[model samples]
Target: MNKKVTILNDKHQRPPEFSAGSCTVTVYSLQPWWRVDLLAQYQISSVVITNRVDCCSQRIDGAEIRIGNSLENDGNNNPRCAVIKYTSDSSSYNFSCNMIGRYVNVIIPQNGTTLTLCEVEVYGVLGAISLQTDVALGKIATQSSSSYPMFLAPFAIDGNRDSNVYAMSCSYTDYYFKPWWRVDLLIEYQISSVVITNRGDCCPTRIDGAEIRIGNSLENNGNNNPRCAVITDIPAGSSSTFSCDMIGRYVNVVIPKNGAILTLCEVEIYGVPAVTKKINLRVKFHTSEDMIDSTTRHNVFQQFQMVSALKLYWTQEPELEHENKGFSDPSPVHYIQR
Candidate 1:
């Protein structure tokens, strides 16, 4: 911009340092980043960036665009949506970031990098539709193995998101093969997503490689269920939601590794209740199976019962036209369709 840029259009050619027509400039630093807080969560769809058009537009290359509800590591630790690998051909670049977050961060990952942005625009829908209620709250939870009483299984589903294990101790398991934590939803649910809060006091990396699984099968202690997502990394004390989109009565967080301990500060499950389908008719005559399902209370065995014993009265006389004109007709076959 003009060296003498000032406020509004009253440029001495001196634009104000923090307003429109002015650019954000950072001094010599390592991996510099610029971020904007939207103050509320949003399901971001895209981001449009206006690089310094006056000069040095090439400096925006290799910069990563991140989005998430985290301030850890200056918000650079959030999930990356896109990287500006080569934007030399244009000063205005748009990136598709279909992410949900309250903050948008643009950072240069290398050492000794400077970030400059004239404008950054983020687009998304309000979070009212993106956020949902927690289904795992106050539900029964269990772990593969445990040695500590304070950090036992139930702590993860207590509706607490405190990341500090020292403050609000999280659920944890003993160092065992394929350590896992499971929550029984009691009823099957069509889970849409799961948010897990990692321990912030220490060992946040221990949560990595954990898989979120959802299913009714308890094979391998529920660890064998279909996976929703694998834990890569969530910033310290940050809760990240993994889209499950699976139907199950149980949700498991398992680390498919030997001699590893699993810890979770909080586990928030969100989804709608699964629609119940009519069970198949349990046609049985002399089988030993229960006559009624213990859970569904639906008849599980065929029972022979007589239909209504109705008296039949018929008149085939054409002289009684008024009485027989609006009469009902009934036909009975020797066999039933159902």
Candidate 2:
């Protein structure tokens, strides 16, 4: 248990203390994490984090908010809401999660840092197809290797950041060549974008040259999926948002088969559920008989009148026959497959 002296030191616990001087102080460790369970799943709209009002308010900087269901790694592997880079005198930070989840974790990653929270307020409602909902909720997260125990593959999606020096704050692959991390959405989606958080404490460059791919192919850990983005460079403890705009069920981040460490604080996938659209067909018939003499035409007109009265028909064109038949009306009416 990373130490939280402030939360323990506070004399009043009825309403959370707003001052860092009066509330909780985390131990100086890598990836100090704090979590709250909503008890039931919800489509979260936003999270409001209150920082210490007194000195060391900056301790809250670079912190991240993760929301999701999986208690794997104690909810540290949930999808991220956002990262805090700066704070004002108000010390109140709001991040739009727009996702569904049962647990919310706030963590600081890397080393030589402490996480202090005066209070954390979560605002959300029952689940719905909310635009703010993170599609990565309860999705399966995996990695190429499990070199470190605490920084295993699950931490990346646990929605927590490893801000302190402890090795437990981030995900790590073996020293093996070509390390990778992948998440299965269970179903296909039109991924609009992906947001990735990198370790801030140290070795931020370890993630450079990582390829983000999206597709259903499991070959090479979905590395063969369409390329979404390649991480050229990203700062420690900060996140980069990439536009994928691709369709797939798996999202992968892999480093080419080169020996390099792959660490991720968090990965967020956002998009709408994939749906199949049916092709609409317009059928027309032709005959040699005159419009008035045609029995089929009379029947069609009657049917159209009834259907149209019920407002089931969308369009009507009496001259459509001429358009299909062409000039002089072809006698041996042929159905044009237009």
Q: What lDDT does the true structure give each of the candidates?
A: 0.70, 0.69
Overall local distance difference test of candidate 2: 0.69
Best by TM-score: 1
Residue 45 lDDT in candidate 1: 58
Best by lDDT: 1
Provide the TM-score for each candidate, comma-separated: 0.52, 0.48
Candidate 1, 95-153: lDDT as tens digits: 65446688889898889977887767677776735444678988899998878778889
Model 1: lDDT of residue 85: 45
lDDT for position 199 in model 2: 79
In terms of lDDT, model 1 sits at 0.70
Error of 1 at 20 (Å): 11
The lowest-lDDT stretch of 10 consecutive residues in candidate 1 is 1-10
